[model samples]
Target: MADDPSDQDGALSRRRLLASSAAAGGAVWLLRGLVRPGSAHAAPGAPPGLPAGLDVYQRAYENWAGEIRTDELWTCAPRTPQEVLDVVNWAYGAGWTVRAQGRRHGWAPLTVADGTPAATRVILLDTTAYLTAMTVDGQAADGSATVRVQTGASLESLLAFAGAGGYGVTAAPAPGDLSVGGALAVGAHGTAVPAVGETPSPGHGYGSLSNLVTELTAVVWDGGAGRYVLRTVGRAEPDCDALLTHLGRSLVTEAVLRVGADVNLRCRSYLDVPAAELFAAPGAPAGTRTLAGFVDGTGRAEAIWFAFTDKPWLKTWAVTPDRPLAARAVSGPYNYPFSDSLPEPVARLAGDLVSGAWASAPLFGQVQYLLAKVALTGDITDVLLSGTLVQDVLTGDVLTHLLLDGLRSDLWGASRNLLEYVRPTTLRETANGYAVLVRRADLQWVVSRFADFYRTLLAQYAARSEYPVNGQVEIRVTGLEDPSVCGVPGARPPLLSALRPRPDRPDVDTAVWIDILSLPATPALPRFYRDVEQFLLGLDGERATVRVEWSKGWAYTDTAAWSDQDVLTGAIPDSHRAGGGPGWDEAVAVLGRLDPHHVLSSPFLDALLS
Candidate 1:
């Protein structure tokens, strides 16, 4: 929000833009909907639904990627829980499949139940359109209180809303455009309690936003019931636990979050920390643990590590900086001046043409942004990356030795399209704590099949035992948010673990959460997924579990599970799963209840039930 003309640190200017044939703040109202043609699985009775006028081309767009120009489901938004059930019921009744979509944020067709033989006769329920309402936690008239937001609401809007009401989210990943529900659905997080004041180092005692979800309203299609039913559960739920972690079978409609008081961070964006020394660096331009004067007030600092480069640089920013330090001349880094309420992508891109043209070098997290910014501006995020074939990735940690080193083999290139979706799952420490924003490239069966960027990077680095190309990558830095899933990870009483079937086995009750995501749009997308997966499996020899991020990684990564049953739960596996119990048993019974006619089923959903 500064108007400094001398803002050489990459501050965007009007004249600089016109000189570069760029437009700043240009708004584009491109059609945003999953225009895929299909129907949700409804019961035997099909209400005379809307006419068959719905078609992909009819709407001019389809959200195969996620909401961000980042992913292909961008066109599909969130719908209310009721809307979710309606779509499910209608699809069931019409003898079509129903794929629950959240922000179309994921790349797998798991959410797509339309136009393809797998789910062509299915209904796609957009989830981003869902809205959220806030109030003081515990009805506090004076003191701070928790805020409940809808699953489909955008995180940017939620933050702004909370800020306006004298509050701020407790934590956030990066990227202002992501939604709360989408983040949690994929286990979004940030580097926790990073070194800030003097010494820049990493620490322990971290967690995921999944641990914050106090409650959630998930739409589990009860196939046997033949009627849509709503079930509300506590943080420690039974049947709802698995759904809380992964968006596989049960579709989430609402996420009741535990919010904190309004607070701002004093961010001092600094950089040049190469990725190679990211973990071992004693200190750089801005080490996360203690940038010292970098952050003033009680606010904390966070770091960004890029993947493509040779050294990991730090694009360090503070939650709040000291007044005296803030008064001094700030770093003239090229930064994105995001608006309080970021305009629609098109308008923002037009404006960026002018504002973004100031610099195109992405070395310090600048170039790829312009490209993505332009891609989004052109409304062809999916169109641009639509020329690949699909393949699988392994995300589960402690993965079988058989799959280890598979990437080093020759099976990779043989796949026409080899992609791996990457996500920053867990952040026990703020410096390393991270979350991933889902992208649109994952929607196409062809694109996600490629190797992940981070994976390749990790594989190359594994030999060296050091990665130095991470700090300040443009693709994911600007976007950050706390887990919006609203489901608390490792919460007391473990609601997420409560609703499992565990009568015969105690292990099913205590499970871990892994996220599902689509591949990035680039060739290195698969590598990103692999590196993160290996990181989760402690492949780095660090002996630490890599935190699972929602949009960060998916089934193919080694950070999460890929077993047929594990895939069903939709989270990383090897730990305990939802156990068997009356509550869980009852919940399973309802899947039958919701689809008595057995008309509602998909490889994605059936995988879960089987």
Candidate 2:
């Protein structure tokens, strides 16, 4: 414990709080049960003393979107696995739910939520302090080396660690700032669908980061021992699916991931594809620069179409051993300084929009497109002329084909550096995200439907003089992680991964993720999101299976997020149960058994698992 007077005062206040709560409610047994075992009160289930080498503090937590805020009474920085175990045991004994806090970069309420009961005692385990140990544990049977790391390690650190040894992941979240534990907890994934000319790589899984884990160490309850202990679970275990994507119901200490040899990558950027042709209706024609066509040309692709802009900045990545013609090489992440750091004009427009100029969103969006075009390509004159030509002379399809010639290229260090391009210091906004799993053949169908829906909704909002969306609509595709990638026989896909193939549609192997981001302050943002959510949710079990992105936003009601009863309690559970095996229920049951007392649960998790 620190020698600071505030620490003493906080401790005194906590003690007094418990005493007063019990006394005010006339609950004598509550006070008796909460009293410290060896203290003057000598209660039975009181929290044990802080273990040595652990620093406890009072801290307030806020989710990435600033939608949820929580102030935990007891928080600690655990330096080692033993420290994590000690904190878990103490919290369990004291009947306090234990939540591991990393970067808190996720939008979901998996850790702590706005609705968590104020009276519920909670303890946050801060993992980044000292739990970021990384070690190469020799090679695995799958040809890739086994790298064991504490879950608290940031993705950037882990990627750098692997890159130092000439190893890398197949795909990862764009933001390098995310912690490995946090990323895996929500099944974080990136856009990397195998191209037509691509070949599967050994020791690499295109699925969520959770899919890369060969083994993990978690602080689970040991009923026989009557205390929390670290248990190493392997990928082959039946309960491993649930653990891989715990959805914030469990605490993982460390994980051993399988990584393959690193490869140089070429990331090409283009901003000429017109929205109508790029997101054309399914099976419109044979030759078109559609999103699916781009994915077919290159295994990796991302489309960032500004709200009301016809042209979207399309980025595609390809594996390359050497530099290509007319390309530059980038050494680290955040390669797009123009996109990550909003330009002066864009910032001003965004500021105005956020400052109650909701009507200016359309104009704000156009200015954003202009800035991105000028900054990325260094030639705004041609782009401006081209946009005018697109609207005036060429039709949608003809204009799109003409614009496809604007592809630019650059080489990046490795998969890790190239894949992580987004920076936290960049734009901040609320987003609704989802995954639409369909067969590769059905890619056109799903994407077209989404694009059409989005376009139609934007038009409707415009007709009503409402510009709710202020950010781009992002689109990406990735191959579902086949169990074979784990090199384990009879291995199952992560039960909670959105990329998991539905039992009814075993042929599905591709997941098209879509997201719409906007400032929370935008007028009618919630209503717009709700409309979009309903449309996506309706796609479930029809053309494609719709699943919420665990780390992003979903379960949207007309007024707020995570508020839709049917979607939360029905649609989401049904999506997890798509395969018909012991699905969400079984996973929840297993997690519940592992923590029988629910010592690792929160109000949000309880509802999600309910």
Candidate 3:
């Protein structure tokens, strides 16, 4: 919305000085190409063929769960497109691989790893340092809005930019810290759909943020130029589909996303619904508060069922033009105060568990459940208004509160604000995530079966004196990013996006995302995750297709995430094939052609792309 080239120049100059100072002062790593103005190289041990005057330094990186960490390596923060292009070309020529580093709020090892030779001769392309420019690129003929953004820009910045420009995404991941480049690369998403009595917005699709991309500009090999150059790919091009969700096989510098008019959203939470009733069998009594029942009532719903507990925290968001009766109006995000900041009691329990009180894991789990219960009930006034209405509007058991209490669940804000509900610093835990795509009719059945399986597995683990999980099982539902909704000529859904709809199952438009969170220290998490992974993957293909969420943990084995040999070699490849379609092959081929030298790669990516 505003232009300031001078400000950009100043910022770049300051970063250059920092890089130069670090290099001159015996910096551990150097930006191979970015030498100080008076120096030939940034550091004495500078690698060959690096361009001078680049912003490079030594930096350590960590993934969200702290499961993925990379030793301090030579990292570059390119502020402009030319800078990125130069870095890629230099890396290609020097035989060094480059990986884009966003917020690293992920569990996968697509970018960097903890150990092994793969971490050698690798450099992190830190996008967040300088490439965060965003501009509204005018409206299309169909009245759809378009905004061009630097890939390194965080979702929070993008949302702020969009809100300022009078445009916004239909849904976004709860954590605002995710970088635009990372989210698009991994198909990050949020829970959203057309409400029961609402009409779908124009130029909006209920899919991952990757679906919002109308065009993306990336640094790719250019034979004509004999160097990597910035190339803008339109959504209609087949290569665009592959780039939409590149899985770190390629690098994107910027993207043009199609967005719609901003809207107000009201999100409410309820925790009295017993897991048994909510996840009951599909044919259970009509009055039961089933997961599907919540979805049918309002398209947006999330259920967080804590381990070793009966009640689940149910959050439902609906598009509301104005505040509903007895609902507390929220001004900003992170409305779940207790969740945003751990309560003292819970923190103490967590500390003790971390301090070698391994056997206290079960007790820790109970404490967490009790904390949530106390926080939810004690602070009802903080998130809701008039406890009498909560009591009077419901009928039958405590579960009835779900029906009437959802509207009064204490937070009302704009879609963007409400979507940014996750705190930047919160519980750090390893999580296994999956997206189960099924038709609306099968939502109840799928949820029930999965919940039953999870419950039984936890019981079995407990029987063996193994408290594998101490956190909650979070479940959310969202519509797939239907390409047709974008209304772009020749637009096709991202080939690799989990939200991509299947051609054979036209009726299967919704995706149910489930997450099981627990600390990495959990004694039996890997085995527990393995069983869950198998159950999800073994679901009836005709009824539901399970796919790993790109940024979240998956491919569970007894020892690690993304290390299940069968999943990596079989299930993953097959799931992307989408019932023997050529899309997967086509996407891989296009990506290969774009980066013939594989300049943009890591060991994990190399294995997957190979």
Q: Please give the ranking of all candidate structures by lDDT, highest first, separated by commas.
A: 3, 2, 1
- Compose the digit string of candidate 3's lDDT tens values, residues 468-514: 88778989899987776655688888988888888777898889999
Work out candidate 3's RMSD over C-alphas: 9.7
User: Global lDDT of each model?
Assistant: 0.36, 0.75, 0.75
lDDT per residue (tens digit) for residues 1-610 in model 1: 3443523634323233222222222212233232243434222222246223222211212232322221122122333455556556665566665544444433333344333332145544455444554443443443344567776666665666655555544345454445566666545544333322432211111134545567777655443665655667666555444445553455566666554544333333333333333333223346343222222322233333333333322233333323333222222211232211122332333233324321211222332222223221322242234332100111122122212322111111100011111221210010111222211111111111112344355447545543323223322211122222233453332222212223343322111222322212222334444554444444222111122333432444332223223323543322123232333234345455544444445664465444
TM-score of 3: 0.87
Candidate 2 per-residue lDDT, tens place, 1-610, comes to 2232324534322223222322232111111122223455332333456566667655556555555554333567887889888877877777678889898888888888864533458878889888899999777554577789998899999999999988888788898888889988988998887788677667776788788888888878898899988999888986787888998788998998888878888888788888888888876678778988888888889999988888888889888888776777677877766556553434545555655678877765776675556555655464446554223322344224333434223545677868988776566667889998888888878878888899899999999999999888999898886777766677777777777777766788889899998865567888899898888878847668788988888887777888888999999998888767656888888888888878888877887797
Distance from true location, Cα of 455 in model 2, Å: 1.0
Give the TM-score comparing model 1 with the true structure, all chains together.
0.53
TM-score for each predicted model, relative to the true structure: 0.53, 0.87, 0.87
